[model samples]
Target chain A: MDVLKFITCGSVDDGKSTLIGRLLWDSEAVSLDIREAIERQRKHNGQETVELALLTDGLRAEREQGITIDVAYKYFTTKKRKFIIADAPGHIQYTRNMITAASNADVAIVLIDARFGVVEQTVRHTLLASLLNLTQIVVAVNKMDLVGYEEAIFEQIKTKYLVLTNRLKLPKVTFIPMSAKNGDNVVTSSENIIWYKGETLLNYLETIPIIPPQTAESRFQVQYVIRPQGSDYRGYAGRIQSGVYRKGDKILVLPSDLPSEIVKIEENLQEVETAIAGQSVVLHLKDNIDISRGDSIVVQGATVEVGSQLQAYLCWFDEKQALTNGARLLLQNGSNTVKVIVQSIDYQLDISTLEKIEVEKATLNAIVKVRLRTAQPIVFDTYNTNRQTGSFVLVHPNNHHTVAAGMIVLNENE
Target chain B: MKINNKSFDYLDALEAEAIYILREVAGQFERPALLFSGGKDSILLVHLALKAFRPGKFPFPLVHIDTGHNFEEVLAFRDYLANTIGEKLIVRKVEDSIQKHRLQDPKGRFPSRNALQTYTLLDTIEEFEFDACIGGARRDEEKARAKERIFSVRDAFGQWNPKAQRPELWHILNGRLDKGENMRVFPISNWTELDVWNYIRRENIMIPSIYRAHLRECVRLESGQLLAVTPHIRLEPTDEIVQLPVRFRTVGDATCTAAVESSATTLEAIIEEVIQARVSERGMTRLDDKLSETAMEDRKKNGYF
Candidate 1:
């Protein structure tokens, strides 16, 4: 079966953890020992019921503060597919944590309180999800029992959320109203909500089609060269970022722009005639060429931008350091790491208002568009076209911390 | 051209991601070591390492922090595998660390060396100046590990500060480190217990015999958990000793690791048992984690891997 990675984000008290706990409990994913452990904890704390949120709050500080401090991953499997949940924090101060969770997710589950409708947190989460290009958006209207399981309340929240989704230009969205605490319309249909006719949250997740973006052009970056002992055997090893490769196909080495033919492909030490995206393999060319790590290999004549200067949208992650113009950092894309300088800050995105504001410097959790100049030419595609090859990370040279995450943006007139 | 249109298997995707991360560890660090224990998780790491750098020798050596309270079966398997692979194996004994530091042994029936193993691991790191250490830690095993980054950065003292972890975005990993700080990389961070078993069955990888069901003398505790009757344990008068078919779900220090009553002689039966299991791996097999709610988090903060 395939895998589906989704994230849950909402305000501090929207019961994102409770929803996930209920899903695991109902699906038989919670073990008996874990259940008994939680039971003991409940009596110690003198709580009326077992707090499902305790399952996700693994850190001591988080438990003491009664809030999720960082993203916690939870896994469960159904007959149809395996699901990976990225349980992100809801507090506004941990926006960077939410971005880290959303970066690799295929779906974004934005939880909203039925009573409060679409709040600022909901808007911000939806905007961030859209910016990350999540394939689908799931708007779960939680705490419906507090609103008396009224369909009108669900409709009102759905309407408000749709306005934000439309403004953000999100393509696919599904709305579900449920009380996570009561298990209403979550894993199974609820008797109280007979008026609503739709698949439950679990069913929707299992059945949603995951269609990867289609690209015919192949791109591969050589991470390590496997040249065994003192023999004539030499191979280029890396993962295919996109497209496919077949034996005897004409390929070109990037930056050097040398041409060769794919004589052999080896996967897991076995020779294969073809390899596709998401598969790690080694390729042997018909003719020996000068190639090393940080080199890109693609089908001959494939269009890939090779330049030293490029524009990208960056999100600052460092709280102690501020990103300023002309700040030198290392930009790592695929297997290649090049020295880069932040040429200029074009604008900063106001997440709540979706407006571009001019900024001279970016601090923690600030999203901005900037221009960067690399010391050497790098091969890449625009972020919208190919996510694997287009995204990069900026690491501070002095402190050795990842300060920003950037997505390459191609100029229209380039 | 015949295009293989079959959708990618989840196992294949996981393996590919793991291999990619392994290659990154080799490419990024100057001196890296694969932290190998005799457990199935680390065994899987070794298997993946072979697939990652086969024709070319491994870029790093395999290092094991021997707790000295380990099962002989597992230690033998560890040596046999290392010898078969023909790679360098470095073993550091926790016994030596305790003696050198003049640490007091715990006063209990089961004197656990679980916490003491950290000193040896840190000493080994300092001795070799390893810039990176690859482990088999999976996020699904515990909650604290779920929040950890793929390339987790530790301070000079080998402490993990959860709040200060860097943001890991996409497949791009940042292995940048200062002179004293080092990184702990987990290539199989996404694989769950069942995924590991499924991959083992698919690949037909051989594991230690203790993972399979065998007759063993176990002392039944009040909590209905089974502890193997080893020399390290001081048996109580009330403890009931019984010989039953059992197997270890996890391999840890003999003083702390527990066993379960099972008859899974083959990998298929083991996979089925894992699917129908009602307890988490650590919940059923580990005694150290039961001490506190945040036991794993606390240990990780203090340099326990």
Candidate 2:
């Protein structure tokens, strides 16, 4: 099965790390030393019982401050599938971290404290998850034991979360009521929740019939040109970011309009007949015209567009200052990067209501539509069609920091 | 033409991801080198590098920091593999750094030169001006490594500010750094010890013979730690030397890397043993890691790869 990557996020003190620790523990993924260390640290922290959160709070500063200061990636596996969990802090100021985690996640597990149901942080994380196009959302209503294991509280939170998910246009949402601290409804069936008739959190994760990715146009951006010593091989090696390519398929080199056919495809140094999304392979064309890093290959008859100006929706990441009009930055589109100017900030979306609010500057976590003009014409597609081609990140030209993540709405001249 | 839509096994997926990361490093960095240790992880990395850009020679070179206490078999295997692959292998000895008065060697009965290798590594990087140094550090091995980015950026002096990492999202690895700064890339950051073993078994990759069980002279310490009786080892009067069959979990500094009593010589037995083991690979072997709670974390901040 394909590996599932997801993020577990919630407001602080909502047991995000505890949930992760419990999952790893029940799955038997934690090593003996780490588990023993967790026990020792818990005792030192004055807790009579083992504090599961200590297992994930890796950095010393995080443990001392009792908060997750940065995003940490954790992995676990069950018999059915392999999983990569991105544990990001739930604080509102760490919106950039949440965005980073959500970008690659196939699903988002947004935890809601049973006592504090559907708060502001919950809405922000869900909206950001939606913005990142996470296919599935699982709202784990935690601390059910603290709430007396009542079904009514779970229903109330579920009702509120349903309203929020509807506003965000989230396609799939699953609500599971469980006590992460007590391991109820986490790995095994819970007897306390007699009214709940759904699978446990782990079971649900294992059996969710992973929504297949959309069939995008075949797009392979040339990452490196490999010319072997004392050999006749001139291969363009890169990952097939989207769609699929087969041997003998006609391809058009974008931005150059050069025609070619994939004479051969090599996977891990062996010739292969086909390559799909997410696999890196080297391709040899029948006749190499001109190619290097930053050039892309699309199906010959595919309608891949090229434009110098684009209308984009971007999440401002830089905390130093707000994103304003006429700002200069380098736009990194896959392996290609070019200088770009922020032409105008059209409007910022008020996340809570999903309404358009007029804003001249994009503050942190503000999702705004803006116009951008690049130095050169770049090949791209709508983000809805192909994420690799449609997305670009703005890097601060002066300091080389990524300032914002922009998704092309469409080419301006489309 | 039909495109193959087969899903990869866990190990295959990991290998593909590692290769993908190596390609990105090749495309981004002006000068890059693989930080090759004679350990199993580095052996796996060297094999992956061969597959990553094969049919063609690797664009980057392999670098090894000789701690001067490495196992003779491991060093010999490192050279043999480098020669077999026909790649440039650069060796920088920590003894050279000590001779140049750049670093101070510890003077103790049972001293490990593992920590001092960092100075030689930094000096080598500065001398070569390598913008990216790929290593075989896995996240599952340590807590601090779990929080690091795949493309971990370091300052000009090679300090790791755990808090100030670039937001690496999806496939866009922001490897943008200035002149003096460099990025430490870990292609197999997600692989576990068992995964590495499985890959080694499946790929039939060659590794040092010490990883297999062998009879060696060992001394039992008061703390229940077993020390191999190498020529460099300082023996205490009360310590008793015994011949036992053991295998090394990790092959690092000879003084610090302890061996576990096991007769599992084949790769399959090793994998089975790893699957049934309780302690982590490093926790069971690396004495340097047991000194403090954050020894790896602290060393990493000082440019230890």
Candidate 3:
């Protein structure tokens, strides 16, 4: 079965944990012993209802505080597909954890309370997901039973969300109305909303196609070299990330555009005829080239020029330090790491309003645009073209801490 | 097209990635080793490494940290696998660390050498100058492990910092380290228990018979744990000894390892039984984690791999 990875985001009281609990409980993912533990805890706490959120929140501190403190992964599967859910925290203090979880997700499930439609937290999550290049957004308006399952409220909330998501430039957006507490329109169709005509949230998740970024005619980023002992053949090792390559395809090594050929593709002893995106393998060439780590090996049809200047959308994750101009960092892309300096701050973005504010500086949990200069030239396409090669993280050299998360943008337009 | 006559999917992709990582360590790192303990997880790691570099001798040796108090069957199985594979095997005893005064014995009724394995492991690493030590640790096994990266960096003193870690992105893994520092690569970090069983079944790998049920003499301890009646175990008259049909769920130091009563004697039956088990693997097997809330975290910070 294919894998489907998605992230869950919302406010502290938005029932993100409860929604996950409902999904697991209704889908028969929880074992009987786990259920017994939940029951035992419920009795000890003097609560009448069995807390489903207890299933994912593993830490004792989280159980005592009654909130998610970190990104806890929950795995389950349907008949058609398998899933890995990254459940991120909703509190403002834990925004860094949310960013780390959403960075790897193929889809973002942005939950919103039906009673409070399009709140600041809701828009912030959507904006964060969009800024991270997660295009598939599923807006789940939870707590419909509290509002009497009113159709008018659902429609109003969906309309407001569509406008907000459109301004964020998300490629795909789907809206669903559900009550996680009562299990309405989550796993099964609810009889309350007769006017609603769409698949349940579970149905949509299983059917969504995980189409990897098309790297069909683009570039290849060489991560390392694979040399099997007692063999004269050597191959460039890395995943294709975007496009396809054949046995005799002519490729270019970036920063010099030196040409090479695909001699062979070997995993172990068996040789493969062709390789596509998402398959990690080694590529051998007829010539012994001066290829090393951090070098981009690209095909001829689609080539990207080397550049030292980059304009990117960055999410500041560090609360202890503020990002400003002339700040030095270790900019990492693929396997390459080089010193970088922040040249200028373009504009700080308002995630809720989608407005650009001209500011000299901003503190933690702020999203903004900036220009950077790297010590070494890096090659890539825009974030829209390839998600793997177009993203990077800025690490602090002194301690090797990941201070900021960045997404590649069009330098000309910005 | 099928790569190895198996259709390409996410799990298969993950398996290929893990194999690629194993091969990379063999090619790049100068001195490397595999840590084996005759456990199911570590057994699975050895199987993967064998497939990773086939038709040639294993590039690295295998090291086992002997606590001097383990089941005779498990220790025999450990030696059996190494000799059958025709690989060099090394054993570093905790008793040696005690004799050298590197570790002090905890004088108590329930004395365990589990935590002292760190000293023996580090000493062996220094003695052999091994740069990378591959382990079979899954993130879902424990909460602290979930925060671990694929290529986890350890300080010169072998300490792990939860707050300070190199950012890992895409399929790019940076295995570079300065002098005195080393990397602990976990190829099965993304796998779950169910996934491991599925793979084991699919590969038809041979494992120790202790994983299956058998009749054994055992005694019940104070913590409500059943300890096998081995010569290494100290028995008292107060301890109730009984004969039960039981098998080990996890193989570790014989003192801390517990056996669950069962009659599962076949692989297919064991797989079906695991599917219906309510308690997690670690919840019933591991006694070290029950000491505190952040026990694993504290151990990891102090250079316990």
Please tell me which predicted candidate would have the highest TM-score against the true structure: 1
Which candidate has the highest lDDT of all? 1
- Clashing residue pairs for model 3: A215-A242, A215-A243, A216-A243, A235-A283
Rank by TM-score (best first):
1, 2, 3
Off by over 4 Å in 3: A191-197, A213-219, A228-233, B1-5, B20-34, B50-63, B80-90, B99-111, B119-133, B152-184, B220-226, B236-246, B261-266, B290-303
TM-score for predicted model 1 compared with the true structure = 0.98
Of models 1 and 2, which has the larger TM-score?
Answer: 1
Over 4 Å off, model 2: A411-414, B1-7
CA shift at B278, candidate 2, in angstroms? 1.2
- Cα displacement (Å) at residue A291, model 3: 1.7
Angstrom error of the Cα, residue A172, model 3: value is 4.1
DockQ of each: 0.79, 0.67, 0.33
Please rank every candidate by DockQ, starting with the best. 1, 2, 3
Q: Where is the poorest 10-residue window by lDDT in model 2 chain B?
A: B1-10
Q: What would the per-residue lDDT of candidate 1 be over residues A1-414, giving only the tens digit for each residue?
A: 889999999999999999999898888788888899889988998998788887888888998999999999899999999999999999987888898899889888899989899998898888888877785988899999999899999998888888888888788689988988888888989888988898899999998887553354799999899988987889999999889899999999999899999999999999988888888999999988999889999998898999989999898988898999999999999789999999899999998889999999999989999999999999988887888888899999889888888888886343
Model 2 global lDDT (CA atoms, 0 to 1) = 0.86
